[model samples]
Target: MGRPRLGITSITLVKTLFLAALDAGAVYFAVVLAWQGSWGFLSFLLLGAGGVNFLLLSHKAYPLRYLFPGLFFLLLMVVVPVGYNIYLSFTNYSTGHILTKEEVIRVLTSREYAPTPPVRFPFYAFGTPEELYGVVLWPEAGPLLLWPDGRLASLEGHQVSDTDADGIPDVLDGRPRLSGRELLAHYGMLQALRVPWENGWLRLATLREFGYFLPQFLYDPEQDMLVDQRTGIQYRAGESGFYSPDG
Candidate 1:
């Protein structure tokens, strides 16, 4: 009788230690979930931890030894679907619903317009095909260096020489201008490059011409409408999407 009582005490001690360790892990997970603002997931973890502790520690739950199987199925049926739904709510789940309303408004408002009269300048492409190409624009204030990242620098005292005697300078700070053959070699990439400006972008119209481009559409938040600059068309936002007057 004495030996059996000692064995039961030892088993109870082991069970208590195991329960404590499990509870500690659950608390750690709860803290992490709370920090991440996942209150729903924290609540679920707490409920599961309580249920497991009750099943293992309570004498009244001894007859219901098969509770774990039921609990496992319950978690599968409830927790998985809940988590998946939460994930889907934060994603672009369907077509025509790609961006949130705020995100769409932000993108629309960032659209910029060019000046009333278009401004164009003569530019020469420099740098090898293997590197990012840079442009030298001949502004009224001598030559200006336009980096690939849209930064403008005045090359006033830089050794820019025009050996050809054309209006456009041929050399910039000792680097010879890229020839027409070199420009044509990387024509596709050069044409696609867009340099940022005050109100719009400077795009390569031709090998010698860099033209300023303005945003085609302008959005008004208060009116919730998009106005086309060239055609003077106003498109109002509807339940389906933006619709024109003709539509």
Candidate 2:
């Protein structure tokens, strides 16, 4: 009588169980890397190698010579990348560190903005039924509305002229006007505008020409600090995190 033999079904079941466990582990690590978003290229290379390894290991009848070629490919894919990463960790590698002089200069220079004399003003919003609108400036100078003709209304000094017969100034030259939803259809062109605010400026922060966003805090590069205009406090960045300027 032949020795008792294990069924082929049992062997297949064992293979399936091993592959399932491998797949679960791969999925768990992938999720962790995705959440961190820092693994960078190594994550992609490993996932590819894992796929190839699965394919090779599942083939039950491969000769040893064929296995050597697959093993070589697997090493090339996995081992080479890890060696490269270990090499990079010891070198000077950072945003500006790797950059050439010209590239570094270009980046450093692009962050500057025109320090226009600060202009601050109190702004009120006017919305139209068509989702278009404009801002009315009070105690400053004029009203800037998104005109139906795809132009900006010059209501600044026109606080007296009745350009429109709606009992309001045709523009700012007349009297403060109410051009809310009535003029919303033209708001598509009402891109964000940087209007002079009190000693500084108020920026239109939306495409709809609605809300205003002011730089409530000022960043001083000279001192490497951020000053909160509202709270009258300064903060600085450091190795631990942002901390009060006093510390």
Q: How accurate locally, in lDDT, is each candidate?
A: 0.76, 0.52
Stretches of candidate 1 exceeding 4 Å from the true structure = 1-13, 32-37, 77-79, 82-102, 109-134, 137-144, 147-158, 162-170, 175-199, 203-216, 221-223, 228-233, 237-247
| Candidate 2 runs further than 4 Å off | 1-136, 140-160, 163-167, 171-182, 203-214, 245-247
lDDT of 2: 0.52
Tens-digit per-residue lDDT, 89-207, candidate 2: 88876223676644533453333232334333444444435433445543434455533333445654433455567544343422243454454454444443444433444444343
lDDT of 1 by residue, 95-194 (tens): 4467766676667655655556867788787766555456788655566788766677777666767788876676666666787777677666657677
Supply every candidate's count of residue pairs whose N, Cα or C atoms clash at under 3 angstroms: 0, 25
Model 2, 114: alpha-carbon shift in Å? 22
- For residue 229, what is the lDDT in candidate 1? 74
